[model samples]
Target chain A: MVIKMNPYIEYGKKAFAKNLVYRSDYIIGVFNTVIMVFIQVAIWRAIYGSNTQINGVPFSYVATSFVLSICFAAALTANDFVLADKVLYGSITTELLKPISINLCIMADTIGNNLFKLIMQFAPAVIISGLFLGLLPPASVLMLLLCVFSLIFGFLIVYYISYIIQACSFWFTNVWSLSVIKNSVISILSGTLIPLWFLPDWLAAAIKWTPFDVIYFAPIQIYLGQMNTQEIIFTFAKQIVWVLLFAVLGMFIYKKGIKKLCIAGG
Target chain B: MRKLFEPFSFYFQHSKMLTKTRMQYKLDAFLCCIAVFVRESAGIVGVFLVLQTFNNIGGWNMQELFFLFSIIFLTYSFLVFLFSGIRDFSNIVNNGEFDKYLLRPRSVLLQIISANSDYFAAIGHGTLGLVLFIISANSIGTDWSFANILYLIITIIGGVLIQASIWLLFSCSSFFLIKTDSLKDFLYWNTRKFAGYPLSVFPGFIQKLLMFVIPFAFVNYFPAQYFLHKPDLAN
Candidate 1:
């Protein structure tokens, strides 16, 4: 029997294989992530001093949220900087000459890199959290299943967001500032630094209206069973919507940027 | 006397060159300034949200916390802006930049630092810290007498020196370790993380580690405690 494979899948596999050669780099990356997780846990532990629950959320749950946050944060791509460099150096012209869509190539590469990191960094982080940090178990078996699905959707949303940011490099010689602003807003609004529950009611509500929460907070909420079944379904619906919306937005920007490139005779 | 001023003049010249090059991209530099402000302000925002949720953490109120945070921010950013080159010392060693620096008439340390002076980035962080410092001082009713002002300046200088010393130590490690990025990352992340909170929050051992082992506690924790009139208390 013969089998057919997608070339994008091949590109992803190549990326994964290429990363394996840099064992020391990824090991350092993992260690950095572990320290981050530990610091976050320690901070939360200090905050919960002598109180089992604050605002109806348990300390154990918060600890678990932080562990998951570190995991997802590690599962991020270098696409924005890579794309920016390619454009800045005029290497993007060569990339454009390829038969495949540059955006699709970016998406595949990001997915490949993130998948490798998720396995290499995230797995060790989870074990470390369980042994040292007193991480809470999922609320239920069903919740664990739902959490995985939510995380996959969350990854898609995050990927599209990165793509959109990378597209901005066409206009700016340096997207460092824009990237920094995006990161700051995401860290706050995504509940990675502190859970939305700890935020003021008005501010928390405002953040909930944005897609940032779906990337990190929603998956953790699902894992902790903080929401009812109805709320869980609603969360999944929102994440899917965000992923679709951002995917369209990213493609639109890429098309316009490419059109500009043609007009410039590049 | 000529030797003493040599480093200063070299730094001034290099910084001037860097400023001219950076000014070529005015809009990008301006955007980066805004970016630095927003990125650094995230920690303050997190502290604010935490304090707003609960009146205090580890017996320190919001105003005291702000005071602690602002001082660390001011000194850390100042150090980073002036000696940002130290952060990439490993790369310099690998790329033979250090060899070139050694051949120059000026001290290598001055050249390295002046080569990487990120003035615009510093402006963003320093401005935010200054704003936070004023607000915090007002809330805490700090008396700005000559002695108090002198003391604050001394403390800030001390903090900057301590931070620079830590980075220098890390840079030295690059001479021995083939891969120093992990060590560098650990030091950088831990100090930034620990400085953002009151030292009292951590377990006793970690507190001691920060206070004596790393002495990062001096960055903000010790100064804030002294000013807040908690000299008798030890976490």
Candidate 2:
């Protein structure tokens, strides 16, 4: 069982350390969710021209939603399967026989990375977004706490989802394509490319059931008080369900995948 | 004439050899094509999303973005096709693969650059440039004076050289730092990602930093703004 720590520390450490080693490797990625915040902010600002509300989201709330989603996504971003890499490259075999679990070990690797990425990816952008486009202060203190809970569950679901995808690489030679598909799905379904708020009503309803929305959108909505008590509870429950589902699924696949792992020289 | 044609023959010869080995696996080419398509299409998807968001990016629309993309694509295509040998520099330097290049009879950079330049690689750039050209003409309405078009062409050529030099600088670092291969990933990622969007969308500081500090702006955004008659972020 993974030891329970403050996930804020757990994830914050992951983000920080990743930035240290690959500090030089600051690369661009699938605009996931925040790109829309900027794009829409520009497009909508041109549309609303200092309006109080659109689709029940005040301009301030809308701005906050975008920043929240982007920072959350970055904070949760991992090295994308360092564990599978260890397995494919024969490094996992040696590490597996070590006392630590590969899953925890890989998670540990991303601790500082998550923090680093936030600084690199989120910091400057936040400052810029705030200066040009201000965000909403939440309606109450209670909402902030709820947002925190939703975000933690959202992160657990995010990392677990990556683990599931990476774990499958044991069975497949080319997980790159699958990794691309994973992010692409996140881009469209998770509200990375566009805000879930702006998605067609039917598409938004359909995506709510999938794990992708739970990654970033769910937390942002929950935090913004856009979700009611019942909806938040349901969303949290769905996130846990996906986490349990993916974790169980990951272990089963790893069992078969380990047998398939051919350490070339060994 | 002999000196001029020697490099051409060298590229053709090695590429022929490379193709023979590559074609031996008939599906490799097809698979590579699919990967390229997915990667490019993802960018196109984002571009589509942006077009949906705004009719104008600083008074320039989708076609203007394509016009900019075309210049970058065409120049990058020619560079990657001819200078692809440099792609292996970091790897080669790390693995001590340079000894073989040194033992050969021609210039090191020239041989290395052309050693891997092949037709399929050329075609990858060809497809992107063609697509961007079509879209640029379609979106921008293609009204330009002869002088304006010529200046745009000149700037693009200069832009390609700047990008090529940066790639070379990253590769050369391997000569001193074998682990510089890690930096290659950084360079490729940042440039590809940042170059895709209009620099103005980023804040003023970023516009200045990337343009001046890294100078990646020259590759696409600066020239795009110039051609499309848009304002500079610095201004």
Candidate 3:
């Protein structure tokens, strides 16, 4: 019997295998996550000194939020430079010539890297931090399932956003700055650095309109049971909408960028 | 003394050429500066937002917190500008560039340290640090006496050395290990993030760890206390 793997999957597998070669990186990645989790928890503990909750949110809730947010952030490591590097080195022309979809190949490669991170980095970090920091149980098994579903959507949202940014490489000399700015914006608005609950009411309200929150905060809310059933459904809808919006925008820019792309040499 | 000064002269020439090359891409250089500025400011914003909601953390007010962070940013600017070569030493080693340096006449450390500099990070972090310093220095009511100014300058220099030494130590591991980037991230980057806030807020063990194991507390927390005189300084 002959079983042929999809080319996209093969690319993804290659990326996954590439990451595994760096053994020390995986070990240190887990420690990095643990330290980050500890720092966040420590800072929160400082803020919550002698008080059980602030603004109606419990200390445990904040702790749980950090654990989930940090782990998800670690696992959501989509290679923002995958396409940018190809475009820069003029290899993208050869990529285009291949019968396989370049977009799928990028996505598959990112998924492969992310899958490795999820297993190697995210799982261990979450377990260690969850044990050390004491994560709150999910609101329900149903909520847990929904959180997982929402997280997949969040990953897609992040991937598409990075894709949109990298697509600008065709016009720009490099997308490094664009990617950095995108990361800063996402980190702040997505509740990865600090939960939106701590933000001023006006700022929090404004952030609600952006796609950033759907990336991390929405899923945390789903798991924490901070949202009611109506709100959960609404948040899921927002995540899906943002994913679709970004995917379409990314494709549109990619098409425009392909037209603008001019390789000087082989 | 002349022999000692030779590497310094060489470093200046190397960095000068590197700067000129980088300046040719004016827009990219400008955007890189803005990118680092914005990226760093996000953490400051997080701290600001948190302080706004809570009013204070572990006896440190917003102004004191900003002062602490300013120290970190300022010292880090200098550290990255001068020691980026050390920070990226493992890459040089992996790329087999270190072997070329070993064959050179000048000191290997000097050649490595003078090889590259990140002017963009220096500009970006320097600007943000200076902005934060001016704002916090004015509002924090620190008596800017001559001695206090001297202490600030000395502490910043000390902070940069302490941080650079840490980088050097981690990069040295590359000789024995295949990769040390993750270890550097775990030890240096992650520890530095913790140093952005007051060390007093952490648990007793974390405070001890930061003080003894990492010594990051001296980078900002303790020096800021010299001016702010926070209650937790005794601990």
Candidate 4:
């Protein structure tokens, strides 16, 4: 008998090659996002001017947050989402019949997709924000490493959450609307559109316990040295917990949804 | 004698489609209204918070500034609702979808404008932007001269044209290049920022770039300054 390797490594390489071809578009995407940051900052600057404060955040902080928000949104972009699309199009039936565990395949596709975004969207947004807005203060190596690890976990959580939404298409074709609603809420709660600090108090408080913040907000803040060690530790812990929670939920939903899938041959 | 009814009938036919689209998802339509209600109301609240921090910006008191903000949002919301499909032009062109538009009997611009009319979300935030503008303007105690009102309309309509033109330009490029998702995102972010605030804060060079190159000032700032009586803004 001959042993075969997982197809994920091949899939990831193909994704990277695809990204290389469309690289200009990705750069422009980051550039436009930076432009948005400028516009947002300009608006807030017009609003704040010389004011000292609003809702407990300094005017400068608000301006800074405006810039950071764009960066974080870019960093967490979930570009690759083959599992959900595969599942919807009945491609997953073929994929599932393979010897590789369904979980590993999903993880591979997501990691490959997100890794491209991580560099193209996330890195550039940070560099641009730092250059125009303010430099992110340096932090301890330990804190930085923890932030990266936590962010990886957070990305997985985001993938799982998105997959769960995609899974709903197993039952309904009109998942786009629900997905839009989910995206808007997640973008807000994840501190992508606006930081949790600037949001309405209730909205901010409602999602505090979730891992969404840990994904973008926590890591970036850690990079900027905004959070103290204990806070960093606590946030990363929360993030890991949510990743576990979502992963479990994803497995359950996929199992249930697989039964509902109507393959033409079967 | 028979050629006169095109644009008018176009608008009417638009209203008919708008009504049906609104009816298609009654619950969604209602929820969208709620979302816009909450979002715009929060914006108004944010505007108010900013006002509290300052007595007047560039000699426009809070009420007048709010009036300006409202007008800007109103123009933006309207265009985004109606002309937003043009923003996707780049992608359409890239995919050779524009070939279909060129083949259509209707005017290309008209078809494009009507192509992706998000009537629900458009009406949602659009109505909100309009009401807020009216409330803010009325509260400001400015007597609207007939000429000033005409200028206000021109500024907004012209501003919409300017923004829509930019979108159209980008969309057309998609005929030359297919993946416009990146450009579309960039344009939206840039537009949202421009729409959200007055243009005076930036340095002269930056302002010139936005005014002459982008001409975004036509949307709200110049018009607002006219009513607010900013010293340097042109007629």
Instruction: Give the winner by TM-score.
Output: 3
Task: Indicate the worst ten consecutive residues by lDDT in candidate 4 chain A.
Answer: A75-84
Return the top candidate by lDDT.
Answer: 3
Backbone atom clashes (below 3 Å) for every candidate: 0, 23, 0, 7
Tens digit per residue, CA lDDT, model 1, B1-235? 9988877888889888888998998898888889989988998888889888887777777788888888988997788788888877878887666788889786778778888877777888898889889888977867778888898899999999988888888887887775577666666655676576887777666677687767888888777776777543442
Model 4 TM-score, all chains together: 0.78
For model 4, residues A98-198, the per-residue Cα lDDT tens digits are 87766666666556766777777867786776687664444778767876776677777777787777766666533555555566556556665555665
DockQ of 1: 0.71
Ordering by lDDT = 3, 1, 4, 2
As a TM-score, model 3 comes out at 0.95
**The candidate that achieves the highest DockQ relative to the unseen native structure:** 3
Real A-B contacts recovered, model 2:
0.06
lDDT of 2 by residue, A1-266 (tens): 77654554555575565456654445332232244345546544444445578577576766776666765665567556577677667777778686645666667666666556566766655656556568666657888787777777777777777787787777664466566656666756676555667655666678767888887887777666787889888888898899899888877887778787765565
After superposition, candidate 4 runs with Cα above 4 Å error: A1-5, A40-69, A79-93, A96-103, A192-207, A210-212, A224-229, A262-266, B6-69, B80-92, B97-116, B144-151, B173-181, B203-206, B230-235
| Tens digit per residue, CA lDDT, model 2, B1-235 | 8989988788788778877886764554554544454555555665555456446555556777677666766777777766777766788888887899899889888878766754454566568777877767556644677987797678767876877787788889888877765555544544555465677666555566567866877877776766666755554
Interface RMSD of 4: 4.7
Q: What are the candidates' individual DockQ scores?
A: 0.71, 0.16, 0.80, 0.25
lDDT of 4 by residue, B1-235 (tens): 4568786577568768877876886765666666655555554555554455555544456676667667766776777777877876666776667789789788888877766666666676677777767677776656788987888788878877877887777676766666666765555445544454566666465577667766667777777766766665443
RMSD vs true structure, all candidates: 2.7, 5.4, 2.5, 4.7
- Interface RMSD after interface superposition, model 2: 5.0
**Candidate 1 per-residue C-alpha lDDT over A1-266 given as tens digits, one digit per residue, 9 for 90 to 100:** 43333878988898888889988888878777776777777877877879999999888788888888877787754556877777777788898887776666777788788889889888987788666878788889999899889988888887788778877777775788888888888888888888877989899788778898888888888888888989998999999999999999988887777666522334
